[model samples]
Target: MSEPVKVREGAAGASDDKPGFDLGSGPGRLLVWLYGVFTVAAASRSVVQVILDFGRAPLAYVLSAVAAVVYAFITYSLVRGGETARKAALVCCAAELAGVLVVGTWTLVEPSAFPDATVWSDYGMGYLFIPVILPVTAMVWLRRSARR
Candidate 1:
C-alpha cells in the first residue's frame, strides 16, 4: 500500500503540484543573477547621478532609474517562479527590449538630447551590449520554461 503525495497550495489558490516551472534553476539561475546585478548597477548609477548632477542629464539619469526598476521587477518575477510570474517577466522583457531599441536609436539620432549616456544608450555599448542581449535571452528562457 503506497501513500499519495500531498500537494501544497500556492499563491492565489494555485496548486503546488504543478508550479508551472522552476525559473530559478539551470540557465534561469544565470538570468536571475544577471538581472540582480543589473538592478544594483543601474540603481546605483542613477541615484548617484541624480543626486550629484541631475540637471546635467536629466533624461539619461531618469532612464537609468527606469531601467533599474524594470530589472528589479524581472529579477523578482524570475525568482517567484509561477505562471503569473513568468507572464509578467515575459512582458517586462519585451518592454525592456523596446526601451533598449528606442533609447539606443535616440542617443544616436540626437546626441545633444542626452548629455550623459543611459544604460540603454548605444544598445548598451558601455556595458558591452549586455543590456540589449539580456532581455532577448530572458524572453526565450521564460517561454521555454513555461512548457516545462
Candidate 2:
C-alpha cells in the first residue's frame, strides 16, 4: 500500500518524520461526528413532521427531508474519501448554506409560510445555532482541502 501524507501546521510548517498513521489526519474526524449529529437531527425532525403534522408544513417538511438526505450523503462522502465524493460533498454543503439562509429569511419575513418548524426554520434557533455554524465550517474545510 502507498504511504500516507504527513500532516503539519500551515500546510507547509515544520515537518516531523514520525512514521505510521496519525488519527488526527483526514478532516480531524470531528467533521464526521458533526455530520452524524446533523443526520440524527434532520432524520428525527422529518419523522416527527410526517407523524405529527405533515399537512401543516408540507414544503418545509419536504425541505427538512431533503436536508436529511443531503446530510446523509455528506456523511458518506466524508467517511469514504475520493475526488468525486469530496466535490459532491462541497456542493451539498453549499446548497445547505443557501437553504438555511433562504429559509431563515423567509421565516423572518413571512412567518405564515411555515406553520410549523423545519430544520432551517428561524435559522435553526431551536438547535442552539449549530445549523448556522456547520455550513460555514464545511465551506472553510472545503477551501482548505480544495486541492483534493
TM-score for candidate 1: 0.89
Candidate 1 scores a C-alpha RMSD against the true structure in Å of 3.3
Q: Write the per-residue lDDT of candidate 2 for residues 1-148, one digit (tens) a residue.
A: 9999887654554333321232224663777788888898899989888889888889888888888998888888777655556667789889888988899889999999988778888898878767778888876875566543
* Tens-place lDDT digits, model 1, residues 91-128: 99999999999999999999999999999999999999
TM-score: which candidate is best?
1
TM-score of every model versus the real structure:
0.89, 0.78
Pairs that collide, model 1: none
